[model samples]
Target: MMRQKHNFVAGGIAAAALVALMGLAGCSTTAGVETTGKTSWDEQGARILEKNVVFNSSSLKGDLQIVDLRGVQAGDIMRAQATLRSRDKDTLQFQYRFDWYDAGGLEINSGAGSWKPLLLTGRETKTVQGVAPDPRAKEFKLKIREME
Candidate 1:
């Protein structure tokens, strides 16, 4: 009779642990679903074009800043331009790339972009431009990093 009681207690503990694990799993799954839904809605929002400028290197960010960013449609083709200003007192070498995205917020040419070199002198501002491969490019991301 005593052994039977012990067995029942062990079984109850096991069941409670299982329930706790399942609750945690359900919470994580719900969070995942919510994140996915929010991402989908953001991609489908009313913005025709989205643009972002990011500096990946800390030194580059300290020395330079993106002054202007704009995109325009030129006869059914998308064109992008950016102005970079150097705040340092010396010449700096940097590399930049423009990643194009479609209307659906999907990258046009994933892993197919080449980095272009740029030189900036102290207190100098320069404007760089890029033309999209096709008219389907409605969004763009500009990434700048320091070059060795």
Candidate 2:
């Protein structure tokens, strides 16, 4: 009877260890699947410049919000437009620039971009537009910052 009890205890321990290993394996597999899904999503997003607007300055973000962003092909050039609305009750001065990129996700002219001054009145909405310098620009990133 004692030998049978020992065998039963050993079998129970083995079964518990197997269950723990399987749980760990399941968790690792789930993590791998999630990582792959995220990578795929990122790759797909990289292919298209989807309505992405980034504010480089915290003050600018607090003062204004990007209401809309869109792009169009005008002849051979890519034209981009961004609509901004002031969230504060005071006038705000900011500088913005458009950085163009090609289909493979590279900047068209790395350091040649210029910042343009923007004036926003209290509680007002404004639209800014830019045109790509060349026909090779397939994407664009619009950056806004507070003017010092």
Candidate 3:
């Protein structure tokens, strides 16, 4: 009787663990409840130029700026403005790219390639803009590269 009882308890615990593991396997990071109503630009976009960019904190001796980001939506047009400043009085040239991702955390390939070049004055700032090809995109990331 004692051995039978122990076997039954072990079986029950194993069953519970399997159920839990299955539930976790089905969970996803990107899939979730989405906004149904009209979404505003502020909710979708950010003034990263004004808030996030900072001047020289180290020996880099350069400043970064963002001017504007507009017309943002889950899967629509997006824009941004940026500026670069250098105290060394040297001209700076750089390249930039934008990437879009969906709610499921999957990257959407626009096939446009991913690099654009710009020239800036020692204390000048520039504006950049981008658009999403589809409406399913919910997140975006911007990448900057210094020209070699």
Task: Give candidate 3 regions above 4 Å deviation.
Answer: 1-63, 67-71, 74-88, 110-112
Candidate 1 per-residue lDDT over residues 84-140, each given as its tens digit? 889998998777777777779788778798878989988899997877778787777
Candidate with top lDDT is 2
Ranking by lDDT: 2, 1, 3
Q: Write the per-residue lDDT of candidate 2 for residues 1-148, one digit (tens) a residue.
A: 9999999999999999999999886664210000000001254465233664444455556788878777777888888888889999998887778878787777888989898899999999999898999988877777776664
* lDDT scores of the candidates, listed in order: 0.69, 0.71, 0.50
TM-score of 3: 0.48
- Give the distance in Å from residue 72's predicted Cα in candidate 1 to where it truly belongs: 0.7
**Per-candidate clashes, comma-separated:** 0, 0, 4
Per-model C-alpha RMSD: 15.7, 17.4, 17.2
Between which residue pairs do clashes occur in model 3? 49-66, 67-81, 82-126, 83-125
Ranking by TM-score: 2, 1, 3
Scored against the true structure, residue 106 in model 3 reaches a CA lDDT of 69
TM-score of each: 0.64, 0.65, 0.48
Candidate 3: tens digits of C-alpha lDDT, residues 1-148: 9999999999999999999998886672221111111123365585222123222223333334444343343334433333334444567666666566666756678656467786777766566655655776555555555553
Give the TM-score (vs. native) of candidate 2: 0.65
